[model samples]
Target: MTYAFGDTDLAARRLALLAETFAPSSRTFMVEAAHTGLRLAADLGCGPGYSTHLLAGALEPAHTVGLDNSESFLDLARATASDKVSFCCHDITTGPFPSGPYDLLFSRFELTHLQHPEAVIELWGRQLAVGGRLLMEEVEYIGTTHPVFTSYLEIQQAMLTEQGNSLYIGPVLDAVPDPAALKRRSSNVQTAPIPAERAAAMFRMNLGVWRHNDFVRRTLDPSDLDDLESALAAIESGRSAVSSVEWGLRRVVMDRVDP
Candidate 1:
């Protein structure tokens, strides 16, 4: 599966901002859903190690391994590796994971990029030790009144649709029955209100990553994209303050039910 967002330096920077924006929600999910005494944890699709570090800090697992396909991101992740925290370059979607049957598996904003998320979840569940938990955080809804924000989302959703993915994949996952060896423990939406400027900054950075995408160039007018980018930049720079964007994140926790 191709990542709509490239893994360039700019993309890494955007992910950094994204990690900062969503850390609170992810931390709360870990605190509420994960049990103590976890021997090992894996942060799937870890980018630049931010989420990996977050997991280590929150659960304090005896060992934590972050897995991703991008070597550049892994390089950054390894730079800050600790005795208890390490990273592996592996495609998380296809795994006989290099590591073990983890006590916990965490992924944030990852399922949206996948084609067969349910199958992937099942694969991940099988890699977990019996009774281990899998925590997933994904987009349920993004509520925004600003025109620029709405426009950006429309284009993004369209592009993802073309790729056989969904930008709003939370409700879709909610409908998926528990995958083999995994039983649904909890699923709920947590609303996070992002400041207009912060939201604009994120949107602008994301637009920069995918504006050159073939689908984007084919489907959107160059002038319109230019306008949207400028508008987002204006908001991000504080020259314009639009209404805040509210994200309803679906937080799902599942427990391994079979060996």
Candidate 2:
């Protein structure tokens, strides 16, 4: 499945915010569930290594492998690598998982892009060592009291739905076998308090990524895209008011229990 947001500089910046907003709590939950000691870990769809870096720092694993299909993303990820942190370029869906029997396998916002997420989970289950953990996070829904951001999300969800991905992949976690557990959490990523200039700048950069997406171009109206651009510009210029945008998230932490 194609990523709705291609690997680009703008996409990388957005992902940094996305990870920063959600990954801390995810790490906390994983630590609690896995009981604090991780020897080896794999970060699936590591996406510019934000989450991978987090895992490396928090767990201080003997080895941390960050995997992604995007060469561009991997290139950036590699720049940040240390002796303990390494990056590999490979498709998470079709390629073999990076050499493992890993203590922890983590993915964020990636299941939604996969056609066979359950199969992937099963693969992870097999690769995880006994007492290992599989941690995942995905967008449950995007919400806002603001009208313009709401419209933006509606359009975003429409494109995702058309591509056969769900904005909310939380329910899919239930279908994974026993030993896996799930929880819902608020990302606490607020939109309103953002300065008009910064919000506009961020959304404008986001729009650039959206405009380049093949699925979005094929699915979203050209005029609607133009209108979004104008609206964001207006909000940036203080000509419009929009408030309180946030994304709800679901966190799933599955422990591998050997039968």
Candidate 3:
């Protein structure tokens, strides 16, 4: 399945900003969930290697691999590779993963873009060593009173829904029964409040990437999109004193159980 956001340079830039904005929350999650002396770790859908680097830094795994399907993104990721960190161009959802029996598996904001996330989680769990952990952070809710933010979110959600994916997939994942090999250890929501300008910046960059999609073109008025873009630009420029958007991220931790 194609990512709704293109893997162009602009998209990479957006992801960089996204990584910067969300790193604190993600780092905290890793520190809280990780065990000492992990042998191997994988960061799923590790676009541009930001989250991969974060994983390595936070957990200090003996070896860490970042996986993504985009060669363009992998190229950027490879530039920053080290003895402990590496990049692989692979689709995360379908995997006999490059490395087996990982001690830790991490994915952030990736499931919302994929179909059958529960199955994906199960697949990831199978690649973990016994008692290894799989950690996922996905959107539960996005709270904002800004009309532009609301409008953009609605359109994005509709487009994802049309694609048979969900924008806020936390609840869906929460309801998934634990697979035999992966027992749920913890599930909870963590709030990350993003500054209005920063939120608009990310949203604007995302809109630019997916605004030309067939679903978007067929369903939305071009003029409205243009106006929406203008409104987002205003917010991104700090001209609008909009309320900060609060992201309620669902964090789930599962342990690979012995078969």
> Over the stretch 177-238, how does candidate 2's per-residue lDDT look in tens digits?
55343222222221223344445556666787777677677777888888988887888777
Cα lDDT of model 2 overall?
0.73
lDDT of 1 at 233: 90
Per-residue accuracy of model 3 over 1-259 as CA lDDT, tens digit each: 9999989999999999999999999999999988869999999999999999999999899999999999999999999999999999888888689977799999999999999877888899999999899999999999997888999999999999999999999998788889889999999999999999999999999999999899999999999999999999999998867889999999999999986
Q: Report how far off residue 92 is in candidate 1 (Å).
A: 1.3
TM-score of each: 0.98, 0.83, 0.98
Which ranges in model 1 have alpha carbons more than 4 Å from their true place?
none
Error of 1 at 43 (Å): 0.3
lDDT of 1 by residue, 41-88 (tens): 999999899999999999999999999998999988999999999999
Ranking by lDDT: 3, 1, 2
Name the lDDT value of residue 101 in candidate 1.
88
Single out the weakest 10-residue window by summed lDDT for candidate 2.
182-191
2 against 3, candidate with superior TM-score: 3
Error of 2 at 161 (Å): 1.6
Clash number by candidate, in order: 0, 0, 0
RMSD (Å) per prediction: 0.9, 3.9, 0.8
